[model samples]
Target: MAFNSAPKQFGTILLGVAGLGAFVLNLPAAAGRVTLFIGQILQALAPPWYGRNFARQLVEIGFYSLPVVGMTAIFTGMVLALQSYTGFARFSAESAIPNVVVVSITRELGPVLAGLIVAGRVGSAMAAEIGTMRVTEQIDALWALSTNPFRYLVLPRVLAAILVLPLLVLVADIIGVTGGYFIATARLGFHPGTYIQNTWSFLEAQDVISGLVKAAVFGFIIALMGCYHGYKSRGGAAGVGTAATYAVVSASILILISNYLVTELFFAQ
Candidate 1:
């Protein structure tokens, strides 16, 4: 019995590793699928079947996530202001605090942090839910009923995430900047008008737009990973757990890597 169980356990581990490796190897294919799916969504004049599902996903992934993102942004902004002030004060450059906060939040921190948070919350949830459905053969049932799973299930989520994340990031940017403003004026002894003026003066249209673009891409990645992993889930309850974990981990890493690439593209001139 012990010998038989040992082989089974080893096989399981081997299979798990192989699955992970396959996931990594298939990144290009996943990217291709994403592009194709996006094209399908964009070309449809009015995909009535997708509308309700998309709205539901928008609420789930975006509206419900605002408080956490808002709190994260505010604290991040405040901490950034304090740290920037401390660093700049050593060089008598304290007046740069507002500008630093604005740039930091809009250019990097706001979208990345928001993406990470949503990955933990929304990504995991999506994976678990879809994984459970897959394991239960619901996805197969949808196919049997002549419904395209990609059209009905995956497209709505991908579209909703792509559309909603930018709005969330925009709100987060405003809240973060306000938090920095409050800290700069109230705790750091900077004049309120000076802080606001400096923040606004230093902020360009590109900084804001670039961050929103990153947010949209991050959202797409999060949803794609979740849907892909979950849709491919096998086994039973354990597989759902694994899918959720993989979704979060993969989405987070992808978001960070994509963020760096986008930053380089936008700022490397």
Candidate 2:
């Protein structure tokens, strides 16, 4: 009997390990599926289904997100300027402050940081709201009514996120530069005219464009993760909570990872 039980336990452990490995392996495939879903939705572009919802989502995801993004940009810019000035001062290159601030904000910090903030704020909210709907059978009811959930629900938020994030990042880039300008000119005693000149002189069209592109991608990731996790939510309240947590965490991680990849692609010679 003992020997028989030992074999059973060993089999159980082996099965568990295999399951874990399969889950790990399938993560990339799951991500690809989600991407494909998004692509299909984008390609379809059915105006009657996704348009009105998209406008509502724009107000929810974009208009409501401004204050947090603005505040974050301002403080980030101020701190970055201070830190950069200190570092550059050691090398007698403090005059590079404006250029560094502009390049850093436009090329990387503005979009990446803004996306992270939205992931935490908007991503979790979306997941929670949609997950609750799923748990309460509202999503099923919609399906019963012959409404395509993806067309009515997911596509709108996704489109809104993609459209709004670029605008938010643009505002962030400008505000961040202005914050850095204030610190550099006021606290550091740099000339305002020269700082402005240095900022514009070093920043190119590509830098701004690249950051906007990244913002759009990050926005899609944020909304996609939220909708995917939320729509597939199971169990009950606990499951809804878990989905929301995973949505935010996964979106944030993907944003950071993708940011590096995009930077490499854009800046690599």
Candidate 3:
């Protein structure tokens, strides 16, 4: 037993060292991926713009995404109102519900929720579509035809996400605030006029703008993660499925991380 314990301990130490080496090896690969993604964005801005593809992506990512975004926003706002009232009651600050709802929605919840929703829906769709093309050799076909896949496929989706997400966030802000107003007036016995006044007075242009900015960044992250995973996919159908899952998960994590960074940039004292 004593002799076996020493061997087992050495094996465990070797495994831990190997794991650390693997992590260190991955760092440069991750940097390469980020570099490639940036290059693609730059290429997207150059000539040979595909208006038709861009329009289609715009409709798909923005218009089709509205219903889900709206539902999430409205429900979030309503819940915030209820919770805010419940919490503030202890301090006799129930009158602050409208201010809290509007501020919270416009400043934080609206963009974050919308980004997460779109990332799950649109990011997965992008990954699936691109991964299918990769596994089917359609991407190679484009290269054979002297067409750049980055410009033709990646640009449209990325640009559409960056442009349309801000608009979606704007709509989310309005719907979320309105939902709070309704909850306040109809159920919470808040004076409609006073609630509106308080919301308007408390919310600044900075809050709305910061959230929209976050939305645009989140959109970029979503599209980038989706396209990157899908474009790099291998192993056929299973790889395609994995790409879709990675797109959603990576986009979501990036959204949360970027939300905090952007907030710090915009509001840090």
Candidate 4:
């Protein structure tokens, strides 16, 4: 009996190995699909666009998202100020708190945190909504009506996210600085005027611009991942949930990766 079963076990092992190889090979095809999808989105950028949809998307992505972003910024700044005080105090460099706060906020924390928050919030929403539309055949209905789904659905959200994220990052930068200032003056007994002066002096335009650039790239990645996953989703409600998860996870990972690349490009030694 054992000798007879040997062949069957070997066949099963071979089948498993083949399946794993197929899965590994499919990664390149999946990447190609994503690249093509991105190309289509960019192609839709030109020509007469849906102004109303774009406006709505802008408000949805930016204005509605402001409160959460602001709250996050303020708290982060406050905490950073306190933390900087602890470290700087050890070296008798407490006077550098304002400089540290401003540079850190404008250069890294503000954009990175805002991108992550939006990825979790807005990116997931985009995936869920689009996936639902896809599963329900709403996208097909649009195609039947001679309407371009990419133009009507994807473009507006993508453009809105790309445009507004920079603005959001800028606001986060301001709010973060303000929060740091408040914490320093009210809790740390810092002189407000001196703190403000130090922040102003140390902050360079390049730092702020770099953060905004990072925001734009992050926005593109977020929207693209969400739309790509949603548009390609199958199955049913389970697919929608999967798409949302993929969107958020992919967007966040890409954001961090892009952040480092952009930082290197901007400030490489």
Number of the top-ranking candidate, with lDDT as the measure: 4
Q: Candidate 3 vs. truth: CA RMSD?
A: 1.8
- Report the number of the highest-TM-score candidate: 3
TM-score for predicted model 4 compared with the true structure: 0.91
TM-scores, in order shown?
0.85, 0.89, 0.94, 0.91
User: How would you encode candidate 1's per-residue C-alpha lDDT over 1-269 as one tens digit per residue?
Assistant: 99879989999999999999998989888788757755654554245476788899999999999999999999999999999988999999999898889999998999999999999999999889989989999999988998777778877888889998999999999999999998888899999987888889899999999999999999999998888778878999999999999899999999999999999989998
**Model 2, span 71-169: residue lDDT tens:** 999988999899999999999999998988999999899999999999999999999999999999999998899887888889899889999999999
lDDT per residue for candidate 4 within 143-172, as digits (tens), equals 999878899899999999999999999999
In Å, residue 266's CA in model 4 sits off its true spot by 0.2
Q: State each model's CA lDDT, in order.
A: 0.90, 0.92, 0.94, 0.95
Q: Give a tens-digit lDDT track for model 3, residues 88-132.
A: 999999988988998899889999999999999999999999999
Higher-lDDT candidate of 1 and 2: 2
**After aligning candidate 1 to the native by TM-score, how far in Å is the CA of 74 from where it should be?**
0.3
Location of the lowest summed lDDT over 10 successive residues in candidate 4: 39-48
Location of the lowest summed lDDT over 10 successive residues in candidate 3:
36-45
User: Once model 4 is optimally superposed onto the true structure by TM-score, how far is the C-alpha of residue 153 displaced, in angstroms?
Assistant: 0.5
Q: Judged by TM-score relative to the true structure, which candidate is superior, 1 or 2?
A: 2
Residue 248 C-alpha lDDT in model 1: 97
Residue 220's lDDT in candidate 4:
93
